[model samples]
Target: EAEVAQSPRYKITEKSQAVAFWCDPISGHATLYWYRQILGQGPELLVQFQDESVVDDSQLPKDRFSAERLKGVDSTLKIQPAELGDSAMYLCASSLVNRGDAFFGQGTRLTVV
Candidate 1:
């Protein structure tokens, strides 16, 4: 059986404010990730975690954007003092260890005003 992920479908916020998006990954999956996509561009990896430990977050803007996989089951991504350029779709994906076919959530589309 297949399981669908979870996240708010959309979000609108003013610039210089804070916003948060959540994702509940498939049960038993050990890997979780957060991605950002600008209009007309492919998704870019923001952060990845393996069982509550960060694997990679070099692309993430540590000053404003933060991601975490709490208890290695659910994840959250937050942006503080969001900028206009930060408006984009935030996607959360999960996969088995070193396996193929990662599943993604509905994605949170953020529009900064």
Candidate 2:
């Protein structure tokens, strides 16, 4: 069975350091998304990409965070000068069609100290 792939399932970094997470969506999926889920809260969309173009990123903290889906396939999310408040589960999801049932990866848990 195909699945979204995420790396470094766990990460710990000091405040002001940089951190990055990677994801590879299931083959043939066209819609990819990045989400941040703080403990005790529902996931919040950080960015959504349809193919290689960004569709939405209103909630993303663009000053310190960024995401990209180069070639419309695998993607990477990065945070510069990571802050303690950035500690959370970063999830990657994909779907075959817009608003379809998305498959999610085992999220990368980030901890900034």
Candidate 3:
């Protein structure tokens, strides 16, 4: 079975530090998404990429967060000057096409102190 790959499954950062997470989607999948989930809440879409282009990022905090898929395969998400409220699970998901069923990776849990 295929799966999405994410690194640094756990992270701890100071209140004003920088952090990053990575994800590699399953082969041939063209739609990738970054989601943030607070412990008791449903995951919120942070960004979405179709191929190498960003198709949606309306909820992404532009001033502190960024995501990219330079080659349309693997992607990276970064947070600059991370804040305490930013602690959450960062999830990466992918589907073979837009609106298709997605497969998710074990999320990166971020803890800010």
lDDT over C-alpha atoms for residue 42 of model 2: 95
* Candidate 1 C-alpha lDDT tens digits along 17-82: 999999888898899889999989999999999989999999999999888877888988999989
Q: Which pairs of residues have clashing backbones in candidate 3?
A: none
The deviation in Å at residue 39 for candidate 2 is: 1.0
Could you report the Cα RMSD, in angstroms, for every candidate shown? 1.1, 0.8, 0.8
- Worst-scoring 10-residue span by lDDT in model 1: 1-10
Give candidate 1's whole-model lDDT.
0.90
Q: How do all models score by TM-score?
A: 0.95, 0.97, 0.97
Candidate 1 lands at a TM-score of: 0.95
Model 3 earns a TM-score of: 0.97
Ranking by lDDT: 3, 2, 1
The positional error of residue 112 in candidate 1, measured at the CA in angstroms, is 0.3
Please write out the lDDT profile of model 3 over residues 3-65, one tens digit for every residue. Answer: 999988999999889999999999999999999999999999999999999999999999999
* Local distance difference test values of all predictions, in order: 0.90, 0.96, 0.96
* Collision count for each candidate, in order: 0, 0, 0
Q: Give a tens-digit lDDT track for model 2, residues 1-113.
A: 99999998999999999999999999999999999999999999999999999999999999999999889999999999899999999999999975679999999999999
- After TM-score superposition, the amount by which residue 25's alpha carbon in candidate 2 deviates from its true location, in angstroms, is 0.3
**Candidate 1 off by > 4 Å:** none
